[model samples]
Each structure stands twice: as structure tokens, then as C-alpha cells.
Target: MHGGTVRPRRGWGGVPKINVYLPDDLAEGVRAAGLPVSAICQRALEASVRRVAAIRRTALSAHEDPTAGLNQFTDRARTAIRTAAGRSRAAGGQLGTADLLHGVLDEGANLGVRVLRALGLDPAALAAALPQRPQDPVGAASFTATASAALELAVTEALALGHDFVGCEHLVLGLLAEPDGSAGALLRDRGADLRPARQAVVAALVGLTRAAPDPLHPVLARLDRLERHTGLAP
Candidate 1:
């Protein structure tokens, strides 16, 4: 029962015991340093378990629905729009491009957020730039003409990209394509140009399509470099 002899719990069933192998020199150094090997290993395992669970949650959220039609939008994209509509309704204003912008950021893991981060813009700051909506309007909130046009353009962007599902990236491009939209204006004011953002989205799609077996691999290594170049990432 000495302090150094304490070991982590073994499995309840027939599971095998886990072991760690270290280089002789490293093992000797650790022993000489009087490190608590079991405690260190336990902490490392706990951190790894948390990381894996987060990845699983993200993957589940991004999973494509099998029942969706060929031309139907991805669940994430649809969720973003629904979130936007809800925001508009709460504000007593019609759904507009600005609401859509907020929705994409709210969705969290979509390509639209990646594009904004790639371009060195804080999504939260961009969201804060949207104009305040009036309260207690007379009628139900609906999509504005510009917002409707943006949705149609999103479909067109998806088709052009040869993707079966419309996504947040397409929605972002659609916002930029719209001639008169507050969301697009806000993006431009934050230095998010259409051409570069479009290029980044295309590159990101390519990387995702060609990603290797490891889920944590840097699919956007080039984009990461670009972000670093722009002082977005360290």
C-alpha cells in the first residue's frame, strides 16, 4: 500500500490489461525523476477520451440523412436556416441575409465558419455588426426578397460545385452573390471578398473530399498556412 505502488483500476470483465512501453533511456530518466507514471498515464487517457468523444459528437452532427432527396439541402444547412427564421421571428422582423449570417455562425462546425476564420475574421464580431431589428411587428416574419434570392443562389452554387447537398458554404457564396444584402455588406466591411472566400470554400471542399483516414489530420493544411500568413493562427 505504498504511494508509488498505486495502480489504476482494472477492467470489470475479461478485458486485457493495458500496458505502456517506453524507451529504456526514457524509462530510466522517469524513474530517476521520481515521476508518478500511473497518474500521468491516467491523466493522458482521460484527455484522450474527452477528445474522442468530442470528435464523435461532431461527426454525428454532420452525418448526412439517408432519406433526404438528391436535391435536398444538408441537415446542417437546413438547421441554420431554421435557426435564422427563429431569430427573425423573435425579433419581429422578416428573415434576411443578416439573420442567415448569424445562423451559420451559430451552427458552429460548417464550412462557412471555416471560411471566415480562414479569412481572419472573428465570427462573433461579424455577427455583432448586424443592425438591431425592431420589436412587435404587425404580421408574421417571412423571408425578404433578397433573402429568397440568396437561397435560390445557394442551390445554384451547390449545383455548380457538383455537390448533391446545399451547405453553409453555398449559403455564404449566395450571400455574396446577392446584389443587395446587409450580410454581404457586413462581410465586405470585414474584408471578406467574394473571390477569395469562394476560392477558400472550393479548396476546403477538395481537402475534405480527399481527406485521409485519420479524422484529426489537417485536411486544410494549406488553408492553415494561409491563416497563419494572415496572422489568424499561431
Candidate 2:
């Protein structure tokens, strides 16, 4: 199935050229399927660039505080916030919780994305439900108050779950806690209730705890407590 060698396109405007490496079986399958491997690789690369840019944006936005502990946000969560910020900036709209939800889906691989997929919710569809705005006359993007509140709640969720790092799963909990946020409303309308989402989060964390034991000890303990409290423990 594999015949021609995959070539790299020349970089333009200071963009570096990248060589793609594919396994024999996968490369053969791509050739057999007549897929546009170069285009697919380009798109994936662009998405990765966007995600990295968003992470940088998120890190820069946070103020350095000596008194307060430094926030430990997973790459996935940072990317989600960055994606939300990018969407708001593009539309000249303030970043909101809904944008954050869209960002989580946009990131593709994360706890929130997995939970939503399990519920048969399409990330693209969730994104479509967000309000679209025309480009602003003077471009400026800021976080809405509600969005800020949700972020704080995300931190709180992480603490409650006994996690040292904030992640996309905590963001989902934040969305669910935000009473008036569009993200929560949209998810609820689509049958993603808070309880089920929490359950999924716990279950996933439990699996992770078993798969990788040391880093997740506190999280596993918290989950055990929660499960017992809810009478869901075996």
C-alpha cells in the first residue's frame, strides 16, 4: 500500500520545516486509503501550535503572587482557557464560561472531552451552541465576571478533590457549579447532569489512581471518601 516517500513542504515567513515520521503499518494504511497525509499533518501541526499559544497566554495572564501558592494547571486545562481566550478575541467578545467549555472540547483529549463523549455529546455541537458575535471594531478580549467566577470554582474543585494540580476535569466541575453560566445551561439541556459528570470524574480518577499509583494517592483517597459518602462504594 505504501509507495511514495512523504516529503516536507518548504517553510515560509520564518516557519520551520518539519519532517513527519509515521510507522510502516500506519503509513501503508494512509497510502491505501488515499488520505491527504500532508494536509492532515499540517492541520494537526496548526492545532498543536494554537494549543501551545493558548497555554502561553494563560500563563502570562496569571499574576505572580508570593503569598499565594503557585497554581499548577495541567497542559490540557491551560489549553482550554487559551482556546476560550482566542475565541473571545477573534469575535471581539469577552471570554465567558461557555467559551471555556468550547475550549475543553477543542483540545480533543482531556477528561472533560472524554466525559462529554461518553454522554454522546459532540464537541463541535457544544461549540455551535455558544453565542457567535461579529468582530469588534477595536479588538480587545477580557474575561466576563461569570467566567472569572467559574475559574475560581475550578480551583476550588481541585482542592476539594485533593488534587495538587488543576485539570480539565476540575473545569467541568466549575462549569457545573456556575449557576447562571451558559456552559452549564447548555450541558444540562443536553442531559449532562452534574451528578453524573462528578461520578464520571471520580471513576476516571479512580482508574488513573490504579494505573499510576503514587501521584494520585490523595485523589484516590478523596474519591474513596466521596464514594462512601454517596453509598456508591462496593
TM-scores across all candidates?
0.57, 0.63
C-alpha lDDT score of every prediction, in listed order: 0.67, 0.71
Q: Spell out the clash pairs found in candidate 2.
A: none
- Candidate of highest TM-score: 2
Error of 1 at 65 (Å): 16
Question: What C-alpha root-mean-square deviation, in Å, does candidate 1 show against the real structure?
Answer: 18.3
Clash totals, every prediction:
0, 0
Candidate 2 to native Cα RMSD, angstroms: 18.8
TM-score of 2: 0.63
- Which ranges of candidate 1 are over 4 A from the true structure? 1-71, 132-139, 212-234
Top candidate when judged by lDDT against the true structure: 2
lDDT of 1 by residue, 1-234 (tens): 113323444665854346676656556767888999867767655644443333223211113321133235667787787667666766767788998888898898998888888888898888778766544333346678788777767766655444545789888988888879999888887888877887778676756756652662443454454444334444
